[model samples]
Target: MTHYRSFVALGDSFTEGLNDPAADDRGGAPDRFRGWADRVAERLAALDPEFRYANLAVRGKLIDQIVAEQVPLAVGMRPDLVSFCAGGNDLLRPGSDPDRMAKKLAGAVRDLRATGAEVLLFTGVDPRDTPIMRRARGTFAIFYLHVRSIADLYGCRLVDQWSMQGLRDWRAWSDDRLHMNEEGHRMVAAKVCDVLGVPTEDDWRMSWPPRERVDPRVKRREDVQWVRSHLGPWVVRRLRGRSSGDDLDPKRPDLKPFG
Candidate 1:
């Protein structure tokens, strides 16, 4: 069994734990967003009281930004384990090339692995049922293929989100239909533990209950609301060349004892 004395997580909002707010559900600050990385760190801490953890993630960052900003910091920390997940923002942009993005990510992975740390990479979640995301399933698939290949070549642990069938359910996602909800984060934490050979009481692969069909009219109304509340703002930001993380900083910049 491999044990990690320290873990550093890097990437965008997913690593930062965006929609999966902590119990208090406060609006500002990074601690309010306790995500899968935090949960996984908690599990690791249980095994070793001296475990140290750091999360250098900011919301709305593209892969290039992560590589340029977070990658060097994480490498300098020289943790026993590193979790890297980025590029979703790049894929969402118009005319973005999956192959190019994959190349960038592969470079970052190579650097992390060079430190002799056990690196963990994540595949983009399967978006077959998601509305706007479903259209770009091919892009996501192409990127994931490269990710899988990179992990194999570099001898890294992979948490294949695409194979997590339970995640296909709408309930598993936040209302934005982009980031995962608390339940979804919980499941991913267990999956990460499973991949890392960490023991946890929770079962990540339990089948979800049968889903009840939604009325077509209600679904249509919901779609309209989502477009107005979420999509509209997203488009505006894209046009303005602005990012949500423009003024934000990494929540946990230093490796510290965590539980």
Candidate 2:
């Protein structure tokens, strides 16, 4: 097997493995190897046993934040292969705009490609039919399309995460109804390996379903219960304040404010 000297992953929560309820140590340490990026890395290393990998993904990051924070690190790594998975948070808003997200995503692709790395772009699954995510279906679909276009334009390998994981099935996701569980991540990793032309082990079957597939009715009820139980007074207070005004201050001095 040919060896890739370095691998880098860039993106947001899905890339960072946020809210993976099935994770053994959820909400404390980040799910490093549990996410798809690390799973891909694990497969790569299994073949070569000396592959170096770095993950620059952070939870709750938007495309803009990824450009600001993660891009520089990835460029510096000069990785042999770089995998990118992002844009879910950008689609979370009610009026999420895919055109703007596409522009930012294109910029990220350009920046990564400038380093001459072999880029692998991982697209996201749409959880719109899920109780918590139904409203953002359009946004996710648009983002996924744009991401595919960007990958093609930049000459990167595109991993169709939506098709690979069966996004139409609510059971493929974690309890949060957002991120993928261990099985889902494994499926994503398998697809990525396929794109990269990496051989899979005997245990790495391509069509395995998730261990636990929550019934849609039960998932909806649990989603409601989670919102009621987890969304405490402080969260309500914060949300109310956000509702009263625009949370994204156009003149915020900290960020490199958009013109």
Candidate 3:
């Protein structure tokens, strides 16, 4: 496995760490915030303090926007390693074309790889596992398959996030049914380390313990609340042509020596 001295992450909310709030005050950029990429960077920095990292992901970015904005910035950084996650938001758009999105993503991968970075890519997860995303399961699958094709064509390292059975488990997600929780992010970090030959203390594929089931009535109420809190706003945004990342800046914009 190559020991990356410099790394930069690109894509969306999943890579931004979202609900997985940062825990440690490590000078490491990824660790200054909590997210799978940050966790991975934390472990890599531990192995080699010379490692430096940056995260350029913002929530709700579309594939074309990522290619147009983040790709150039990442190429400029010229990190030895780049982990990219995109297309999820695009796939969710109404009347989205999976092939077109995939093509744009492939182009982005090509540009980023031209900078001589070992680009890593991820596929969208199964929507059937989430109540909110269920309506778009078919679309997500189309996007996911194209990602696989792009990975093969470009020789980019592919982390088949969709194949991770553990991710389907509700424990791997938050109530929003979109982003992963802190525990889920940690699991993903461990998985990425395992993929890149970084040693980990435990397996990320472990299943959740069985627990008593919640009442069906409570589940219904939770669903109603989710529609009100998350889905309703999402609809409004679509209607108003706005995005979650409309005014958001990259969480960690520069790559510097990490603790």
TM-score of each: 0.95, 0.76, 0.93
Off by over 4 Å in 1: 24-31
Candidate 3: segments with Cα more than 4 A from true spot:
23-33
Ten-residue stretch with the least lDDT total in model 1? 23-32
lDDT of 1 by residue, 33-95 (tens): 899999999999999999999999999999989999999998899999999998889888878
For candidate 2, write residues 1-259 as lDDT tens digits. Answer: 4457678777766665444433335465443335776677677776655567776676656678778877887788787887777777667655778899888888888988999988888666656566545677777788888888998899988987666435455555665556677766666767777778888752233444556756999968876776776445325645564421123221111111111
| Weakest lDDT window of 10 consecutive positions for candidate 2 | 250-259
Query: Of models 1 and 3, which has the larger TM-score?
Result: 1
| Clash pairs detected, candidate 1 | none
Number of backbone collisions per candidate, in order?
A: 0, 1, 0
All candidates in order of lDDT, best leading: 1, 3, 2
lDDT of 3 by residue, 137-168 (tens): 88888888888888889888888877778888
- Using lDDT as the measure, the top candidate is 1
Stretches of candidate 2 off by over 4 Å are: 1-3, 19-33, 165-167, 202-220, 229-259
* Candidate models: Cα lDDT each: 0.91, 0.67, 0.85
Look at candidate 3 and give me any clashing residue pairs.
Answer: none
